[model samples]
Target: MVEIKTPMLPSNKPLIVGKIDVRVGDHVEQGQVICQIETAKGNHQIKATEAGTIAEILVEEGREVVANDVLMVIDEQGKIQPEQQSESNKEILTTVPTDTVQHHLEKDLLIIGAGPGGYVAAIYASKRGMDVAIAERKKLGGTCLNIGCIPTKSMVQSAHLFELLNEMDLFGIEGDFHASINMEKVLQRKDEVVDTLVSGIEYLLNKNKVTVLQGTAHFLSDTEVQVGSTIIKAKNIIIATGSVAASLRVEGCDLPGVIDSTAALDLHEVPDSLVVIGGGVIGLEFAFIYNTFGSKVHVVEFQKSLLPMLDADAGKFIEGICKEKHIQTSTSSKVISIKQTVEGEYIVTYEKDGTTSYTIADKVLMSTGRRANTNGLGLEHTSIKTNKRTGEILVDEYEQTNVPHIYAIGDVSSKVKLAHLASQQGCVAVDHMLVGKHPISDTNVPSVVYTNPEIATVGYTEQALKEQGIPYKVSRFDFSANGRALTMNQTEGFVKLLASEDGTLLGAVICGPDASSLIAGVTVAMTNGVTVEQLTQTIFAHPTTSEAIREAALALIGRGIHQ
Candidate 1:
């Protein structure tokens, strides 16, 4: 007989047996998963080193085990001789239990988070007359309302107002007056906004009669979960744990002056100078915010362009805008290290063009993307599948996992991490479960980046079409020629529309004032399959920002009324 022992894990702690995939008397192949263990990081699979037949199981599910602990006995020759079978082996085989029933509270649906995805699903399911219970370890509105979207946008509005005030002379208002910013009040107002929204969500949940359980949820079985001491069993379960900010692995990343997006939102005061790593949406938004507030800001991006996912022309236009605002940007750069000096300043070392350079600042914000929060949810307890590389849960059009009744939504399963998308996905999942069928295409989702001049896009991008080899035509209209934009003195960007050879509207890209709100119309048009000719025929108010959209559509058919 050969012994199958647990190997050393990444975290050197006693791991609990999460699942067993094999049973006694079953033949196993080499490197086949026999079981899995739960650790501090996540689940780790235990595989057989050689082909063998399972003779005995030494550990049961939910038992704590350490390194080199014998998990099972496998007979290499596919059979255990009577002389080789000892009393201990027979006792082990006899003592192992196949299953156990734990006491649990019954419900119609159990949602495993209180974020946008979870709460939305609970409320929708409850409205359909299902007994729904939601478990959350933190606030009701999750990261978006509390820290991510609403808070940052509030700060952005403050910075925008400040910018407008600085240009009062251009608006024919001459004054010998000055204004100053008090970060304390700014933070207070942000907190107030968050609190009001959170209270509103709480009221909605109460009105819908959805039970709110305050605790962390762990799956004890496919249909059962334990939230603190209470066990919840439901016919359907939705996992929507959201995501956490990813961290850089370089040295000194954990220093006092270094911070993440969450820490950046709660700063007591803006630093004299700031170094932002990663030139993505979060990084650039904060860079513009701090720069508008009179801080020397520098953005470091590893890619060749800022907003690499956007159209190349749009990204270059924004880069020029950043330069005009005196915000420093370094593209095609890699950060090597960050160190603190004796004077309490941070030195960021990076490589560009095969040359090393350094920049000093009072604080460093690590705005590197985010990772799905799928770890530690006990996913191995069920047949639900996840991406091995990104740890994102795998789901179908209806957000249903491999297991029919189990579902995943939001950052945990979606490729797009926006909160609004999560809320929409939640509604779709509820419709699929209670109603007959409701399909929502992810391609119809819109994306927005709220900067000085916001950027928004919906439908297929130029790069995406080129990659897919789809024949397309493009039309462009500069906002500089739009009467409303020129009148407001905000004519620094343009609008571009993409359509198929047959004149079908494929997508729209807007890079100028109110792009966030303007994209809503484009999204609605695309969702309803509105053609370019139809859009051009629709009347738009004269001298308005939306006229730019109509102009672009008209230009597609060579009938543009404006430049």
Candidate 2:
């Protein structure tokens, strides 16, 4: 029997839809498109080089598949053979164009996307003595420094400062509490922050002797990347193109006033009233920011609770805080349509519990989610694989994608969407590339939400424990019981710990002042299997917020002193 394998296109990226274009029992001639692939670079059509009938479709559409794995077997007569390719040959057949793509023997590594992961990867690779070149289509520092995390955090900080000042009256301070926001200045500050950080990345790259190619990069072959007209050949390539705002499917989603998270950050004028669709971290954070700026903000979430993926108690705390701020939150609601009104406003129609309603807003921000930025780089040229629903790169613990020489990390891999996680994953990918070791474990990944109260979590939750039928006990300590919280007048959160039956710390959640910051200690403890007993015996700084964590651990064994 003869096997038909998809040939790598001149663009060396992977086939997105592993053999999706071809089917069992379908006869294909040489050079016929057998599958479609996508990468951070772009999409491409992979053609079949063997003239034969597909005997079997080995992988599903939108699934990542490696090169040389016979997509299907054909009989000696070029008919269907009905057998799949063996696993041993999959690695050998991984259609990396090593031969066709000229290799710059000296350049060991090439990276795409200069986001948190890309820059970190380049730095680490250069440290390991690899000749590294990074190609970026847009500004350095990618979306986080430019449009997503950093800029948004700056805006959030501004809102936080404004909110704190407004609350000064509660502390017996009396003055003109009224403040006017100058969006131009705010935006200029954001620009300055982005520019400084981006320049820092540029400086880092140059300081490390890494080459920076400014252009949209596309895979010209498995071993070669083309940035504009120049082709960069490296033995290893890391894709960290990151992600973009997931498109909302509601009507008029493309309207001018209906903006995604990126556009929302670029605002030079704060709208009088804004409607945010999606109550996830981004939505709630923005809602609080805009509300602090004196904009009437309303949040609509399709889920039953805002930040449902987080600890339910944490979401409840934020919901209560948001309510106190007069920020309306509607859960179990979905946006049906959006239309621009004649009065230069947006008419947003949504449904809650099957009841339809309409709200008018000066601006509409959609914070639904983000998809992997895997369009345009041409993945169809090589045999790499991904999940169709997410377009996220499929990788092993070592961050090895279907193609061994090519690796994917960060948002593109969907391991974790946080910038910190992406940075860690970049290190893991580099470590594996350099020493054949995987440095990250999914359970050890920590995630932080930068909201008013700030949510940070690492490891499992009580709900996850219950779902998994793991025996566990819970303990809680409120910040109100902590001296430092009272002194700061910000005691609206608690630290809760879930432990194993024997009292080993399993996971924890904190929702209050610096919740995101406080989560780190607990996360490290959980990752290293620190027990509640050990945590209780440890000395804690007096009159500090960290004492709450210690108290929470002590509470688990019914020996909490402060709580």
**What stretches of model 2 exceed 4 Å from their correct place?**
1-106, 170-173
Query: Candidate 1 regions off by >4 Å?
Result: 1-103
Q: Across residues 309-359, which tens digit of lDDT does each residue of candidate 2 receive?
A: 887887888889889889988899888999997889999899988899988
Residue 112 in candidate 1 has what lDDT?
Answer: 89
Q: Please, what are the lDDT tens digits per residue for candidate 1 over residues 176-283?
A: 768777899889888877865775576578778899887788898898898876789998889989999988888889999999988888888889999999898899
Worst 10 residues of 2 by lDDT: 97-106
Best by TM-score: 1
